[model samples]
Structure formats: structure tokens, C-alpha cells
Target: MIQTILLKQRPTGRPKISDFEFITEESDLTLKKDEMLLETVYVSVDPYLRGRMSDAKSYVDPFKINKPIYSGSIAKVIASKHNKFNEGDYVSGMLDWKTKQISNGNGLIKVDATKAPLSAYLGVLGMTGLTAYLGLTEIGQPKTGETLVVSGAAGAVGSIVGQIGKILGLNVIGIAGTDEKVNMITSEFGFDHGINYNSSTNMNAAIKKVATSGVDIYFDNVGGPISDAVLFNINKFARMIICGAISVYNNTELPQSVSVQPFLIKNSALMQGFIISNFSEKFPEAINQLATWLADGKLTYTETIVEGFENIPKAFIDLFDGKNKGKMIVRI
Candidate 1:
């Protein structure tokens, strides 16, 4: 029997651990011509999961009732019924949140832990990694000596974005929800400056103080009032990349949309929002660069790991509440 976590119903507010049920399932060796049984090691819980909860039009489908929830997970092929993944091979792919998963070997890809940590394949070196790379590279387009601002600055994707901006010769100012988060971002993630949104008496003043002149590139993760504050300091021709809005993820009603349209008109700013899935063609390049950086110590990642199958929903809830430091994951 394998322990698994399954979605029960659409949640209206904060998702408790009980929102997801931990149950046992029978395992079978029955295989198609090409298949494998994978043992999950780490499962990523992201803000994107909240979007999947609503029965709204989006990139992915809503989680069906009674179905096991699946997300990007790092796993090892324990028993192979397929030629693609042999037994004992490490891989990272979308897998059910459980002890073991049976797959037909389609989207699964081999993970090279000799180059980076296995858990990294679920975070900085995975889909979230790709999203950070693509959104910044394609939209942010920071130049030398330019000022860059990253919201949710201590997160899996935001931290990487800020690090990359520093590498590209930009002064990176990050906005996080807490003081500890601010400390980690500047001390650990190589950001030039960091602001704690929660403590800022006047957020606009705090942003203008750290960013000095103005923000040249904005990599936004937690949008809302924080974004509005940054939007007030945008430099001419500034670029903003909207990836995930962790701030509004748990809101029952539509969030109050701020009129930043004026910033675009005033600064000639280019603000483009993107879903990571749109960059499929660029995954290989992203993975290689992220892996190289990880091995070279130029990139670092932190994960808030919750052990056991039943805690998946709580891990997700923590993400929106900013209770997590970096990538939020469930260890199975």
C-alpha cells in the first residue's frame, strides 16, 4: 500500500491539513509497454496551486474532487517497467503527492544530483527556476548599474531573480513580508537591498530609500499594495515581470486591482505577466544555467519542507501567508 494525499473539495479560505486526506492505495506492477513506479522524495507547493483550485479559465485544469493532487516532485525510479527510466535513476517531474507513483514515462526527466541538490530539482533548478529565468530574461531586461526591485524577494523564484540581477550588474532591491525574510534575502541571496513590507511605516518611502533614484526592473511575485508602492518609483522605460501574486492567492473575492496603467503611460514602462509553462522551449537552457550556478555556489536555494503526506495543504497555505522562507515543499 502507498500513502497518498488527495483533494477533497474546493477550499473557500485557509486550507487546513485536513483539507487533504492521507490514505493508502494498492500498488500494482502491471505495466504498459513503457512505465515505471517512482518513489517521491519532494513535492513543491506553490501559489499556482491556488489558481488550480478555482474553476476558472487558466493554463491548467482545476483539481477534481477525490483525485490525488499532483505537482512538480523529485522522485527516484524504484522499479522500471519502462526503458526510459531504469531502476535507481533520479528524476524530477509532476507526480502525485504520495510515497510512490506509477508513470508512463512521458514528462519525467533525469535529475543530476552530482551537479546540484535533489530537492533543487523541485525548486530553483525546476519549473519555478525556469519561470524566474524566462520572466526576467525576456521581460526584465536589466542593464548595468540599473536598479531592480523584486517582490516576494525571498521566495524560490524571487531569490533567484534577485541573484541573477546582481550578476547582471544591476542593483537589486527586494521586498519581503518580514524582517527575517529581508535579512535572508540580502545576506543569503546576494540582493543589494531588501525591504520588509510588513514593517515599512510608509512603503513608498521605504522603496524609494533603498532603490535611490528609481526602479529599472521589477520582478513581482506578491502583488497588491506592495506593487503599487514600487510602481510609484518606476524609472523611464522600466520593465515589470508579473509571475505569481502570492498576496492575493487566498482571497475569496477578486482583489482590488490598482490602476498602475498610469505608470505605464508615464514611464513608458513595459509590464508583462507570464506563466512559466509558456517557456517550454527554453527549459533546457534554463536547467543547464541553473544547475551550473548551483554547482558553482553562485546560486543558493532554501526550502520550507513539511514532512508527511497529509501536510500538503498546510504547506500551500503557508506560502500565501508568507510563513515560508523559500520554496514550500512536502516531503513524502
Candidate 2:
């Protein structure tokens, strides 16, 4: 039997576990020539899944109702009819929320479990890592001695961004939702400063206090009021990378806020939004560099794992609650 989670209803605000329905069925796992049957090991629960739940237009297509939701999943080949994949080989791809699947090896990347942990392919050595690398280097164009401010600093992408900032000799300031996460960013991730956005009444002042010289690059993960605050501190020719907007992902409308275009124009700052796929052609280069850094111990990461496949939806919901320290993954 294969267990799968179906999106039972479109959510209004923060999603509830009730919005998801789990079902089990006798999956006749079969493979034709050039195909492989996979058994899921780790399921990734990311913030972007929230956008997919809505029927509205976005970078990725909305997940269909009554069908299994799909994201990055690390699986082991239980049976293979393909020459490229052998039984017991590990692979990662955009597989379903179900426990089992069949694929023709397209879009599936063979993972060397010996090089890194299986879950790393879904995180640090995977899309999240690529997102941080591409956004920071290619877009942010960070330079030594400049200030880099990253919101959702303790998250999957932001945490890595901070560490990479330090490696590049930038003054890295991270903004997280909780005190514990604030401490983790500063004490563990080598960030220059950490601000607890939840505790601070004056977010703009808090950002200014740490970033005395002004922000040279801003890696925005959670948009909304936090982003509004960061805009007040951009340096001339600064770059702002719009990564994720978890803060307003559930909003029914595009909430209005104070205009930031004036600040951008006055400072000649650039703000650009990107889907990780924009740099797909260069993924191998970034992935290899990230791996080298991880191997050399220059980079560090954390994962919050939920123990069961049935807990995938709960793990995803926890992201908005700011319950995770780094990447959130579900171990199947």
C-alpha cells in the first residue's frame, strides 16, 4: 500500500492539517524498460508549497485537488528496468507525496549517498543550496566589507546565504522570527548579528543599529513588514534578491504598503525575483562548488525532520509557525 496526501481544499490563511487528506492504496508498482520504481526516503517540506496550494498563477503550476502533491523527494530504487539505475541505487527528483513511484529516469538525479547524506540532495547539495548560491553570487553580487542582510535567516536558503556572506568577507546580519533562531544564526552560523523580528518593536531601528554603514545587499526571504523595514537602509547601488515571501504567501490579496520604489531609485538599488530554475543550465557548477565548500567544512547546515510520511503536511505547516531552525524534511 502506498500512502499519499491529497490537497482536500484550498486554504484561506495559514493552512491546517485538515486541508490535507491522507489515503492508502494497493499500488501495483511496476516498471517498464527504461523505467524504475522508487521507494521514498525523505520528503522535503518547503515554503513554496504554500503558493502551489492556491489556484492562482505563479512560477510553478498549482497542485490539483484530490491528487498527490509533489516536491523534492529522495528515494531508493527498489526495482529497476533501466540500465542507468540499479536496484538499491539512491536518487532524488520531483516525486509525489506517496510512498512509492515509477519514473523513466528523466529529471531524476542519481545521488551518491557516500558523498553526502541522502537528504542533502534535497537541501544543501540541492535546490535550496543552488537558490542561495545563485541569488547571492549572481544577483546580489556581494563584495568584501559590504553589509548583507537576510530575512528568514535561520531557514534553509537564508542560513546558507549568511555563511556564504561570511566566507566572502561581508558583514552578515540575519533576521529571524524567534530568539532561539536569532541565537542559532549568530552563534552557530557565524553571522555578524542576529535580530529577533518578533521581539523588536522598531524593526527599522534594529536593522539600522546593526547595519550602521547601511545595507549593501539584502537577501529577502520573508516579505511584508520586515522587507519594508530593510528598504529604509539600502546603500547606493545595493542589490535586493527576492527569494521567498512566506510572510504574505497566504494573503488573499496583494496587501498594500509604503512605497519602496523611491528608496530604490534614490539609492540606484536593484531588486530582482528569481525562481531557482532560471539558473538550471549552471546548476552543475553551483552544486559542485557548494559540495566543495561543504567538504572543506566552510559551510554548515541544519535540518528539522518529522519522523513519518503521514507527518509531511504537519512539517510543512510548521514552517509558517517558524518552528524550524534550518531546512525542514520529512523522513519516510
Candidate 3:
């Protein structure tokens, strides 16, 4: 029997811990041929999980009532019926939020933890890292010395986007909600400039001051006024990669409109939305590239770890409220 978190119902406002409950279930532990038993380590709580709580049509199906939630998790094989893996082999992928899990060889991939921290496979070394890579490269098409602006810039994906922009020789600017996060992005993450949107009354002026040369690329994690502000400051033929809209993820009603459409029209700019699943076939290549950068000390990542399986729901809600630093993870 494993204690797992279950979504009791859909959220009404900010998701309360009451919407989820910890319960135990006897899972299939006895492995058949080519099967394995896994012990869970870390679970990811991303902004995308908020969309899964609603019935609205989007990139994926909503999280069903009374079912165990699934996300990126790091695990160790305890018992195996397959010859390819044995006891103590570490693996990572989408696994239900249970202390122990059963699986065949299909989705699980073995890893060597000696090369990097096991938890890295859940942050910069894994799916989240890949999202930043493909989303920025294929979609943003950033160029050297070009001005790049990124929203949610201190977060998991945003942090990677800005760092990669700097690595590619672009003048990077990050927009975050807190003075602490703004400082981290500019001083720690190497962003050429930083904007604290929460403290600024005029978002347009702040963006203009930071991106004085005008933005050539924008990686938008938050939509609404922040995005509207970025749109107005973009240069001609700029590209906007709409990776997420975390600001409105919890709203049950329609969101306010942005009055910045004229900028897009005047610039003849390109803006496209993406889901990591769209590039599923090339995930390995993305992961390999991210891992190389991480191990070679060319990249950096952060995790706002909320301890205990009981804290998963709170961790997710924190993302909507801009309370997390990088990737939010819960340890079971």
C-alpha cells in the first residue's frame, strides 16, 4: 500500500489543500516479465497542472475527480522482472503521486545519478529543461546581440530562457514579480536587465527602460497586461513564444483583454503557442543537449522544494500566486 495524493474536486479560487487528500492504495507490486516496481522520490508541480483542474479545452485532458495526479517524478527500481534493469536503478518520467509505483519498461528510462544529482532529472536535466530548450530555439529563434525579453523570468522555464539568451550572446531582460526574484535574475542569472512588474505601476515604461533597444524575442509565461506591455516594445519582425499563461490559469471567468494588438499589426510580428508534447519525438535530443550544458557547468537551475507529499497542492497554488522561485517540487 502506498500513500498518494488525490484530487478530490476541481478548485474554486486559489486551490486549497482541502481539494486534495492523502490516501493509501494497494498497488500491483509483484512484477511480471518485463515489469518493475518503483519507489518515488521527487514530484513536479508546474503551472500546467492548474489547467488540468478545469474542464475547459486546452492542450490536455482535465484531471479527473478522485484520481491520483501524475507529473514528472524521479524513482528507483526496487524489484524488476526485466533483464535490462535491476535493484537501485534510477528512472524518471510521468508517475502517479504514490510512494511506490508499478510499471513495465515503456515510459521509464534508466539514469546514472553519479553524473548529476538525481533531482536534476526533474528540473534542468529533464522535461522542464527540454521545454526551455525547444521552446526557445525552435520557436523564439533568438539571435546574438538582439534584445530578448522573458516573462516569469525567475521561474523554471523563464530562468532557462534568459540564461540561454545570454549564452547565445543576446542582451537578455527578465520580468518577474518580486524584488528578490528581480535581483536573482539580474545578479545571479546574468540577465542584462530586470523588471519588477509587481512594484511598477507603469509596465510599459519599465519594459521600455529595460529593453531600450527594443525586443527581438519574447518568451511569454504570463499573459494579460505583462504580455501586452512586451508586445508594445517589440522590434519589427520580432518573435513571441507563448509557452504559458499562468496569470489566468485559475480564473473561472473570462479574463480582461489586452489593448496591444496594434503593436503586433504594425510590426508584422510572429506569435505562436506551444506544448512540449508537440515535440515528443525529439525529446531525447533536447534532454541530451540540456544535460550536456548542465554537466559542463554552462547552465543553471533552481527548485522551490516544498517538503512532504501532503504539500503538493499548496506547491501548485504557489505557482499561480508567483510564490515560487524556479521549479516547484514536493518530496514524498
Among these predicted structures, which one has the highest TM-score?
2
Q: Which tens-of-lDDT digit does each residue in 38-92 have in candidate 3?
A: 8888889898887788764653678888998898898889998888879899998
Ranking by TM-score: 2, 3, 1
Candidate 3, overall lDDT? Answer: 0.86
What ordering of candidates by lDDT runs from best to worst?
A: 2, 3, 1
lDDT of the candidates, in the order given: 0.84, 0.93, 0.86
- Deviation from native of the Cα of residue 318 in model 2, angstroms: 0.7
Candidate 1 global CA lDDT score: 0.84
Clash count for each candidate, listed in order shown:
0, 0, 0
Give candidate 3 regions above 4 Å deviation.
Answer: 56-59, 259-261
Clashing pairs in 3: none
Error of 1 at 86 (Å): 0.6
